[model samples]
Target: MATFGKYFLIVWTILFFNFFMETQAPPSCDHGWTRTPNGEACVKMYIRPPKAWHSARRACRDEGGDLVTIFDETKSNFVRDILAVNNTTTAWIGFHVILTEERWHWLDEDGTPNYTNWRYGYPDEDFWDPMVRAEECAIAAWVNGLGAPWINYVCFVTYPYICEKPLPSKCQWNDTVCLNIHETYDGWKCLKGRDGVARIVWPETYPPGSSGPIISGYALPILRSEKRRRDLQ
Candidate 1:
């Protein structure tokens, strides 16, 4: 009888969860920004009078983002298309020389670029010298009859720029489930429970005897599944 009661409780919980989902909205980007097709980040192009590389990056920071970082061919192409669509000839990206590391790196990333789209005979070695290291900044530019490609330029040169920020990852309605699973849960901080495990209060509407706080599960496959669904959407 106890086993039957537990089984019925699980079924009822799932039903209520599904009903709750029907009224919840999916995660979204801020106004004036567009989410990437793969949904990993948000991007916006600033077309005001061109600003120097540092100034442009500062503007993006003021808007809660940093200059865009292109990680691979897909992101490179996406940035190119955006520039082409905006009639922009060139724009500052986040890539810049790390003099100490002797390699180019994105502002928000630790490692050097795994993929790059350098134009012919570019990323000029001239500025790699220690004295000129501060001068080399990267830009995406369109050449006559050629696709957009990156070129190293002096940091003081003014150009419109692109800004990119991470997409919101807060679970739409599964925060309690996600908080118990990932240490980096974006929704809310987890609280220590009586048993020294992470836990959350059960929804008052759940099965009658289940109104108290519940312990974190050994695994939260539901949260993982939700993340996959969000990424795919």
Candidate 2:
């Protein structure tokens, strides 16, 4: 039930990911995300004072990413440093204690974390409060309180948060309108369709477009852009 354009976008997205991820070079972070040394992910802090953890997560998702999820010690330390630098007391992350399983995991259910940074004697399972719902959220706690930097907090509690998503590769095109269109669609531009025909994007904006006449050497860039677009979409 998907359109041809939509299908091409999906495929390109998957292929172009390597240009930024696991790369020897990533150029730089996107407009908002902060690029790390390894360029594994782009992260941003949302220090709008406070919002319920759930609402904070939703905000991140709306921005085409999700609440921060610390997957390893390096990432954990990086997050802690961000907090320390900003003098943040605590922030929501994509994590919660799975009370039924008695284990911490990303809210996306990526499975039990290979690494953990829990505060000692915490997540007691025995911990409870009338205002909180069954102890189902975690925070990047300040390193002052009970020891470690990770702890559980009420899901409804308002707290600043971090959001993260993968960074995109640098793409330069001479056409400004084409550039804007590509950026809008996760950096993918459909220059051609799979049917060996011109597939000009934003036809109203650009007349004498692909639909008008097929040009030589146009397929490659279009195909590449379509691939990235699909993955991001």
Best by TM-score: 1
Tens-place lDDT per residue, model 2, 154-223, is 6888989988876654333321112213333244332222233433332222233332212223422333
Pairs of residues clashing in candidate 1 = none
Candidate 1 lDDT by residue in tens digits, 89-142: 899999998676777888977875688889999989888676665667999997
Off by over 4 Å in 2: 1-27, 99-102, 128-135, 144-148, 170-233
Q: In model 1, where do residues sit more than 4 Å from their true spots?
A: 129-134, 169-233
Candidate 2, residue 147: how far the Cα is off, in Å: 8.9
